[model samples]
Structures are given as structure tokens and as C-alpha cells.
Target chain A: MTDAVKISNRNFSVFYGAIQALRGITLDVLAHQILGIIGPAGSGKTALLRSMNRLNDLNPNCRVEGQILLDGEDIYQPEFDAVRLRKRVGMVFALPVPLPLSLFDNIVYGPRLSGIRARARLNELVERSLQAAFLWDEVKDRLQTSALRLSGGQQQRLCLARVLAMEPEVILLDEPCSGLDPISTSRIEEALMALKSKYTIVLVTNNTKQAARVADTTAFLLQGELVEVGPTDRIFTAPKDQRTNDYVSGRFG
Target chain B: MRIPPRNTQALAVTLLAGATGLTLAVLVFVIVFILGKGLPVISLGFLFDNPQEMGKAGGIFPTLVGTLILPLVAILIALPAGVGTAVYLSEYTGDNLATRIIRFGTDCLAGIPSIIFGLFGFIFFVTTLKMGWCILSGALTLAIMVLPTIIRTAEEAIRAVPAGYREVSCSLGATRWETVLKVVLPNALPGIVTGIMLSIGRCIGETAAVIFTAGASLRLPHSVFDSTRTMAVHFYILAREGISNENAYGTAAVLILSVLLVNSLSYWMMNRFIARRTK
Candidate 1:
């Protein structure tokens, strides 16, 4: 994993309308390291991922406070273009949602948005991205087909390829393999393992085993607060906090 | 429990008998009578060609064109605006007083009478705007009349798109506008199309609103600025004026057939588009 300062959220609090979703969350995602944020429902795991790119800003009642820095630059600073930030900090969702376009279009949507043209260039990018996501052989022949027609597992990989094609330095994945079968889950884990070499990976997942299998570091969150964060081995085998121990031991979420 | 098996059977029979005798009979009778008295005089030429062969009282060609052209124009104006408004309400616009007020206004407009819409259309489109008694005036009136339905239905459809989809889009670093355009709109296309079809159907059938704004003329409209007649208006004029009873029947049949054709085509097109998308 490459070492560089990437995304760091400092004392960030988020509210949905009058309800507080995240409370004073502070975290640092190192460059090229897979950071796993694990928590039960409503622990603000997903909210943290969204806040990185200011996706929560779409909600009129949603309000955020404190600093979120990307490469030591304040992302919330007005001069920083949110649109451009999103293009550089791409994401994959829990359920596969390839935009209702052809598979080829789905893979190249981000690059095209960033003004990448030339059929040869796009074709190369598509092939590389699909290969990176381990989805090329299954979908290469039918890239022209609608992305919606693919099986759920294939759709998820297609979404991964889509994000990869943008060539973003940071990749945010929110429970990327939650809905897949065992083989599909293993494929995604393999892809994420390969991806961490080049991209800074921040993953939010409920699967403790999956987190241990792929993450360099693991954070345990409960009730919208980060309880503990450390190396995956330390967090799982020897958690410093009691809550993290209970969580990792399956005693309580 | 078995004290009155015969009585229970008798009660069921009586209840179903009353429903079949009263409710079903009225519905069947209404449809049969309307179609029975309205079908014989309808012909191909009466439907497709402009109503120019027999003065203002014979053919309904101009009216047919007017009915199709104006509503289609109105739909062209309303589809994007209505769907955009719905997207704003469902996806972008927050729960604010302005959004609430717009929703309330739309609801009120939906309940307003078409005659009142005609009066408003006359004063606004015809006099205040001085658009004259043209098809543009008529189409503007119809668009305003149908806007509420389109907004309400489209809003519901947009709202029905699963939150998971929106979350997925946002998480993918799609800006709010991109998410709404690339994800929400495509997912909600079927429902939005249904709303448009409903509005089109209403616009085609409406006469009271078009009557005051769209002057009763038998000539084909070369532009939206030209006054024109519609099939519904022709049906009314033929039925009321002492022209010929057959003309009225033929006009009504033509109106129904045109509406059917529009509805069928919309259904086919939208279904095909959705099927292709899913494929």
C-alpha cells in the first residue's frame, strides 16, 4: 500500500433535519490503506462514507460541522468543487446499482464525465477496469447490453468497474458485498485486495470476517460514535475497548 | 353453525343478484348505449381527413386535428416541466413552506372546474395576453388545466423510487442533479409517462375549457396562433346545432377512437421503452 495523506475527518458531526446522525466523528484514511468501518444499523457507518464526498449535502435539512480534509485540503472549502471532488473520490454501493445504461456506458460514465474521449482509449480503460474488478470475462462479450440485465453479483462488479474506470485515488465502498453469494463475495474481496495496492480504500461493512480478511485497519462504531480503531489483528484478536470486544465476539452489535 | 345453510345461501344469492341487477346493468347499459348509438355513422374519411368537404357542420376533420394537435402540444410543454417539478418536489426540494404551498396550489387547481379554467384562460390567454382565439390559447389553457394532475402523479411516481436507489447514486459520488437525472428520472419514467397519458386523455376530452379559448372554426390550423376546433367541440356543436344527428354520432365515435388510439400508442411506446431498458 502506498503511503500518503488522503482523507481525514476531524470532529465531524452530521444531522438529518433535527436528528443527529453522526456525533463528533474523527478519523483518518491513509493513502492506499483499506480502512474498514464496521457497525450495526444506524451507527453512522454509511453516513461517514457519504459525508466524505458531501453526498449528505443534497438533503436540505442535513447539516455538517467541522473539517473533512482530502490530501490536506479542506474539502468543504468553497473553492473546492464538489463535482470534481466526487469525480476524484468515487464510490461503490452495498447493492449493485449500475446506472440504467449499457454495460459499456456504465464503465465509462465517470471518465466521459471528466471529458475522456477516443474509442480506443475508452475501450482500453473499460477492459482494464473490468479486469481490475475481476469481471471482464463474464461481461466483455456483452458490454453493449443493458447493465440492468446482469445478475446481482455481476452488477456489483460492474459498479466497481465503473468506479475504477474514473481512475480515482480513493475508493469508498459501503457494504459492497452484502447481497452477494459466497463466490461473488470472495471475488469482491479479491478485487478489493488487488485495488488497495493503488487506491485508498475505505469500506463500511457488517461482516466482521470480511473486514478481517481484507482491511488493514478496522474501526468499531456504535450509536453513531467511533468506539475503537486499530490494526485489524489488534481490533479483532485483542480489542482495546470492551465494546469492540463484544462487537467482534458477536456478543452484541 | 349450520342452523341456516339455506338462509345463508339465499342471502348470498340475493346480495349478488341485487349487485348484478343494479350496478352491473347500469355500467353495461351505459357503455352499450353510448357505443350503439355512436358507432354506425363513423367512417375512415371522417376520422383522418380535414373536415373541409362539408362546411362547418358535416365532417369532423378539423376538430380531430385540433384535439390531437393542441393536447400533444400541451403535453410537449407539460412533460418536461411537470416531471422536473416532480423531481424537485420528490428529490431536491426540501420540506419547506414554498414546496408545501406549491403542493397545496396544485391540489386546489386539480379540484377547480374546467369552466372556471376556461374563464381564466379567456381573460389571461385571450385578453390579458392578447393571444387571440387561437389554438395556442386553447393549448395553454389545457396545459394549465392538466398541470396539477401531471405534477401530482409524477410526484407520487418519483417518490415511489426506492430510497436505496437514491442512496446508491449519491454514494457513487453522483451530484444531486446527476442522481436525479441519471437514476431517479429513468427509474420513474413509466409512472411519469402514465401521468402524461392521463393528462393527455383529459385534455383531449375537455370541451368547456377549449370552447371559450379555441374558437369553433372548421379550418386546419397552420400554426398554434390560428384558431381551431376540436373533436369534442365538434361533437357538442353537432349535437346541439340542428345540423344532422348522424354527424354528432360520427363525431363522438371519432373522438372515442382517437382517444383510444392515443392511449394505446402511449402504452405500447412506454412499455417498449421500459422493456428495452430492463433488457
Candidate 2:
């Protein structure tokens, strides 16, 4: 992985109403690498991931303190347009949502909304994005078919492909494989490994083993606090925190 | 007294089926009775030719034209405002005091009687605004009457769109307007169209409100400012004025058929929308 920091969260915190979900987090995400966040329920993994893209802005009660920077520039600056920022940072939700449209239209939705109206360019984007998500061969025969008809696994990959079509600089995934079966999970992991060479990825997962299998650097969070973070191999085999050790060894979650 | 579970199940099914059957039977009976009394008077001449002598002879053509024009005008005026209000209420505003007040106001408007609306229209549009007993005055009244329906339905439709869809759209860098236009509007189209269709039906069948605002003139309306009589108003006059019972039935028959046509189209569209969404 490159030493260059793609994102930095300095003394970052998140609160919803009276509850604090993330507290004073300071972390660096290296460029062109997968940073996996593993935690049990109520550990604030999703909140931290959403904070990267400012999707938390959608919640009325959500409040943020401190600063988060992308490429050494503070994202929370007054002039930063959330819409434009989203173009640079795409997100995939846990459950697959295919927009109830034709597979072709679903993939092209982002580009079309962004004003890429040329039919040929849109077609090229659909093909390229689907191939990158490893969904091209399966769905190439029926591009115009309704995306809702696809199987669960296919729909999830289509969602991934839809994000890919945006050509975003960073990809934030929140428990993307939590609902998938073993085979589908493996496919997603493979796609993520292949994609990390091009896009900075932050993944939040409940399955710690999945993180160990794929993440270059893994952070273990507990009750909205970052207990430990290190290279995935060391974090798994020889973690610095007892909680991380206990969690990784499957003694307690 | 405890009843056997199987017997209770059977009794509940019978009661529910009987309720449904009774409602359908009443509807069929009313439709059949009207058709039986009126179909003989309905000929092409009766439909196409202008009435002679206060609708006692000739045909009901001008009233038919009025019925068509009034609703068309009302829909053209009301659809954009209604849907716009609904989008603003559901998407832009959260559940708060302003939205609650707006919703309560809408519900109150919906519950007001048609004749009360007629008095309000006569006072506001006809006299106060000086629109002068014309199609425009009448259409404005109908537009106000149906605004609640259209707003309520459109809001429900927009709200029914999966929240996840909005999240996805925003994540892809779409502006709020872009998300609403491309994602929310398309998904909500069938419901919005259904609401408009139902509103048109209400407009077509409106008699009390139109009579007060749009004077029952037999002359064919050349413009929005011209006074005209709708099918429902014509039916009321012909029946009440004792002009010609035959002509009155004919007008009632035509009005019923047109209302049925619009309603069924809306129902069909709604069913298709539901099916597609579920699929």
C-alpha cells in the first residue's frame, strides 16, 4: 500500500440526539488500500464509515465535532458541496437496492444524472462498470431486463457495479456482505481485492474473519471507541489490545 | 360461550364475503336501473346535436362539451400545484409543526361539503374576483375542491417510494432536484396520474358547485369566460325543472358512463403500479 494518506479523521466525533456513536476518532486511511473496520453491534462502525462521505448529514439529529479531511483538505469546510463530494466518494449499502429499473438504466443512473447524456458513453460505462464488479458475463445477455428480477446475490453485485459506474475516488461499504451466502460473499471479497488497486476502500464488517482475509489494515472498535488498529496479519495473530485479542480469537464478541 | 375455531373461521369468512357481495350488488343495481331507464334516449343525434328549447328536445351536446372543458381546465390548473405541494410537504419537510398544520388543513378541506364549496366559490371567484358565472369560475372552484385529493394521493405516493432509493440517488451525487425528478417522480407517476384521473371524475360529476359558479347556460362555450352547463348540472336541471324526464335520464346515463370510464382507468393504472413495485 502507498504511504500517502487518502483520508484523515482528526479528533472526530458523532452524536445523534443525546447518544454518542463515535468518539474522538483519529485515523489515517492510506491511498489505494482497503481499510477494514470490524466490530460487534453498537460499536459505531457504520457511523464512522458514513461520516467519511457525510451521509450522516441526512439524519436530522446527527451532530459532528472536529474535522475530517480528504487529500489533506478539510471536507467539512463551508464551501464544500455534499453533492459534488459524493461524486468523488461513492457508497454501497448493506442490502442491495437496484432502483426498480432495467439493469442498464440502474448502472447508468448516476452518470445520466450527472449529465453524461451521450448514449454511446453511457453504454461504455455500463459495460466497463459491470465488468469491474464481475457481473458483466452473467448480466450481459439481458441488459434491458428489470433489475428487480435478478437474484439476491446478482442484485448486490449490480449495486456494487452501480457505484463503480460513478468512477468515484473512494468507495465506502457498510456491511455489504452481511446478508450474502458464502459463495456470494467470496465473490464480493474478490471484487474488493481487485478494486483496491484503483480505489481507496473502507469496509465495515461484523465478520472479523472476512476482515482478516481481505483488509490490509484492520481497526477493532468497541462501544464507539477504537481499541486497536494495525496490519491485518498482526492484528489477528498478535493484537495489542486484550479486547481485540478476545474478539479475534472468538472467545467473546 | 366458546365457539369451535373451525366454525368461527367459517363464520368470519361468510360475513366478510357477504359484506363484499352486498356492496357490489348495490353498485350493480344502481348502474342497471339507470341504464334500463335511460339507454333508449341515447342516440348519436341525442349526443351530437344542440338542445332545442331548454333541453326539452334535440340533444345535450353543449353540456357534454362543457363537462369535458371544465375538467380539462381544472386538471391543467390543479395538477402542478397539487403535486408540487405534495413533494414539498413529504420530501423537503420533516414531520414537524408546519407539516402537521398543513396536513390537518388538507384533511379539513377534504371533509367540507361540495355545496359549502359552491357557496365559497360563488363568493370568492364569481363575485369577489368578478370571474362572472363562467367556465373559468367553475373550473377554479372544482380545482379547489379536488386539490385536497390530489395533494393527499401524491404525498402518499411520494412517501411510498423506498427511502433506500433516495439514499442511493444521493450517494451517486444527484442533487435533490435531480433525485426528485428522475427517481421520485417516475416511481410516483402512476399514483399521481391515478389521483388526477379521480379528480377529473369528481370534476365531471360536480353539479351543486358548478351550478352556483358556472350558470346553467345551454349555449356552447366558445371560451373559458363563456358561461356553460356541465352534464351533472344539466341532469339536475332537466330532472328538477320537469323539462323532460327522458332527456334527464339520458344526461344522467352519459355522466355515469364517463365517470365509470375515468375511475376504471385509474384503478387499472394503480393495480399495474402495485404489481410492478412488488415484482
Compared with the true structure, what per-residue lDDT tens digits does model 2 show for residues B121-213? 999999999889999999999999999999999999999999999999999988888889978988888789878988898899889999999
For residue A249, model 1's alpha carbon misses the true position, in angstroms, by 3.2
Q: Which stretches of candidate 2 lie over 4 Å from their true place?
A: B264-279
Put down candidate 2 lDDT per residue, A87-171, tens digits, no spaces: 9999999999989888998999889878899999999999999998989999999998899999888888999999999999999
Report, for every candidate in turn, its global Cα lDDT versus the true structure.
Answer: 0.85, 0.92
- Candidate 1: which docking quality band? acceptable
Query: Among all windows of ten consecutive residues in candidate 2 chain B, which has the lowest summed lDDT?
Result: B270-279
**Which tens-of-lDDT digit does each residue in B1-279 have in candidate 1?**
475888989999999999889998897787676668778766676566666434343457777788889898888887778877888887766778999999999999999999999999999999999998998898889888999999999999888888877765655556678778877888888888889888998998888999899888888889999999888888787678756667777777767777778889988998898777656
- What residue pairs are clashing in model 2? none
User: How accurate locally is residue A207 in candidate 2, as Cα lDDT from 0 to 100?
Assistant: 95
> How do all models score by TM-score?
0.89, 0.97
